[model samples]
Target: MRTGVNLAALATIALAFPSASSAQEWGFPGLGNAEFAAITAGGPAPRRDLTGAWDPGQAGIAGGDNYFNARTVPPLTPLGKEMLSRNRPTHGPYTAKVFEGNDPLTTQGDPSGFPRILNYEFRPMRIVQTPKAVLMLYSFNQSWRIIWTDGRALPQDPDPRWFGYSVGRWEDDTTFVVETVGLTERTWLDSGGFPHSEALRVQERYRRASENVIELTVTITDPLVYAKPWISRDRLPLKKLPEETDFLEQIYAASEVTGFKQNIADKARTQ
Candidate 1:
């Protein structure tokens, strides 16, 4: 139901870094506003059936509770190493606590699932589909972005953001390609707070492999923050309306807090 407040403007802010949680008094400039804008932008409101049903392809492996469970994800190179070294936290499970938003992760903090300083970047992203656009729903920190399928151009010197601006175009019937830019260094690439500079450019290919399944392939290229292009994908089943059970409800009730235990465990080790 939101209206013309400049989708390009909102896009420029989100495609910046990882996700967020609560920035008590830290006025992170465009970050909070971008979050507000994400909640209220776009003209021709997108669809809501993305929660209907979902199917993962046979080739898709079970990413498990933690996709980066110290086993999956690509290895970090020297630049990646440098980024981590420079931003690595002093104590805790992974890095710092700045990545509770933008990053697409679960409530867990340990990306390696190992003990280290934790800069958590875990969030659950929902999907809102329509004939003209696709809205990715983020539950980690109430973060999200609007992918304009109606054809738009990227802004110059955008206001820099945590999630950045995303614009999508259909390659085929079931496939959607999205380009995102205008990010900040304040966020992480995943739950582990894997680093990425503002030069980060994200390209995603989303396709409905079947009637009830959707696959999202992401290609991240940021020469300043990464040595090679970071590639990964995710799968989700559409939560059909007829079988309406609010997944977010369950997540908040207890499942989401499961990650908080890692923080507790981290504290135990430090003591």
Candidate 2:
């Protein structure tokens, strides 16, 4: 009877404590479960930090040189079309090579704003993250943007800025979302001469895909220019750069239009 009792005790132990594999297969709910096991054990997945020098990846737009290459011309309102017609990039479809297109960059202006900065400039960028703000330092024109992440509310009537006022928050552990407004109407939206009014609002979603790659998506909303919101379909994959890569200063100090053309052309040839 003692041997029989020993066998029964073994069976009870087997029934009470399932094997790890069996527990996983049966989808058990507890600290030892597959999905919650790590969390319950006081460990969680590491969050990605977007603090590095990055190179812009392939932006597949035919006959275009920058990020706006693939975007179809928005169904512009009358004012929008008129604004577009006035844009004359040096090498764009509408302008002659000798005629410097009205691109504000031709006048050494700040690449006007976000989409423009991303599209026109091919140099590497560095991101610096802190508790209160994130700073994006561009190699182009030595420009920098400050994205406040300190839980401060966006200003209701902010003074217009060349780069716009930006606020950011983490959407998930891997994704960061930024909203920008109060941009000066003087700047163009892209090197292709897309126009935006002071009423424009830009939404940017940045996701760190891996240690080496980051993906960005931008959506532009301007009731005055387009019939609807314009969200870019292109996934801008930014590849990580070496730690030793230098972001040299790009100063536009040429005073004459001829000097500007010569300087820009020389720089383009090297790139």
Candidate 3:
């Protein structure tokens, strides 16, 4: 009877303190084995250093200006053109006239998604690198995007998301290529109200130009919206911000404050 009790206690102890390999297989408390593997895999060989706060510089069609004025708008299908005609943007490439147009940003909605998020929103973003993922945190709305670098395939049936699902792979020693899909169609493609269907696929190539600069080339493909795939004319150049700078300011503060004032004015008028 004592031998049986001793054997049971040993079994319990063994289960409680699993081997390292078994622990890895079982994964961390809240994460799964696959996630653990991804997180532990580290980045590609000769990992390119892309850690920094990047500023979206200048204002033009290409540099986060109004999407409509950014060069010539991409050739749109008939449906796409109709959608563009229906959109009224309060902010233009050069100015903002909030009272004259329908600006989604003023509506306190999720305005930054995909290519639009990359556009000039007058906010800085920080890039944080980890073994399993590259995290892009935007100052606007305190938004974040995760670019998974694990050797896992994109989901076969991913749920629609505001920013879409993203998977990234290294192209060379200095460039990282990312592909995204499964985006919701409710958001505009740009501040100028460019439209896209759920079938939109965005491919982004990020090249570390130097220690202080990164260049991004974006390609948009959507058969439902455009007659052909279009590449952005401007190869966006992001300048690294100083390490001491803090990007904690709220970019959407004006919109929220104006909205509250408008509510008060409306109430007074009704009374």
Candidate 4:
């Protein structure tokens, strides 16, 4: 069993069960800030290659807003504010009561979806570069997404999807960029319950800083929601892991949550 609670665990109501090989470790064995720095200091990065197992360490886990360290969340429009006011999230500074939360992923076991997948519970993931697409396999919820890289244009008037449609390109020798659209508005922007419109567009920039490190930045732009675009993740460093590294299975099933609530969480409401 885990010793302490973290924001991601609380927000998702999920537990990570490590592989038998990693039973001795406390949490997923991610590098610390100093350790990541030391390990990533080597030679130049390769060109047009992002295939590796990556761990963001403690820096990827956000207690509140994931954008710009919560220092600069752009002001929301009137409609955006109204929509956000209706959401009852269980984590962050403005969290509601546990029973009052309406988070889709936590309470109903809906797919985390799009930016939410990257913003909250951001765990160790594996990136596989294929000839046609770049596939991202996330340890959290055991989910995966594909970003097409075969020079196709974004779909027009496409049906919205949970993960959305993404296309990627090499911006430079060291930088790879991905653009995503057609996301359903059901998912919150973060654990904070920030709302977005159907017009929401997300851009992800991945820069290979070294042989063992990649810096990622995400930008959110929704004209109907915020007055201006803002950065969600700012230069979050992902340290490379060995090829054979195994990730914990962290699935949050609806039936499991129902049982836990009835047995454990509901007991708290009476107290």
Q: Which candidate leads the pack in lDDT? A: 4
Assess each prediction's global lDDT (C-alpha) against the native. Answer: 0.46, 0.62, 0.62, 0.77
Off by over 4 Å in 3: 1-47, 60-66, 93-100, 253-271
Off by over 4 Å in 4: 1-38, 64-70
User: Scored by Cα lDDT, where does model 1 land?
Assistant: 0.46
**In model 4, which range of ten residues has the least summed lDDT?**
12-21
Worst 10 residues of 1 by lDDT: 110-119
- Candidate 3 vs. true structure, TM-score: 0.70
TM-score of each: 0.55, 0.72, 0.70, 0.85
- Candidate 3 lDDT by residue in tens digits, 36-69: 1222212232347677666554431233333555
Q: Per-residue lDDT of 167-221 in model 1, one digit per residue for the tens?
A: 8877777677889888766666644446777787888776655433345666778
lDDT of each residue in 42-130, candidate 2, tens digit only? 12222747886665633422134443433455588888778777777654445434434557766554454665676555456778889
Instruction: Supply the TM-score for candidate 4.
Output: 0.85
Q: Which candidate is the best by TM-score?
A: 4
| Residue 241 alpha-carbon offset, candidate 1, angstroms | 7.5
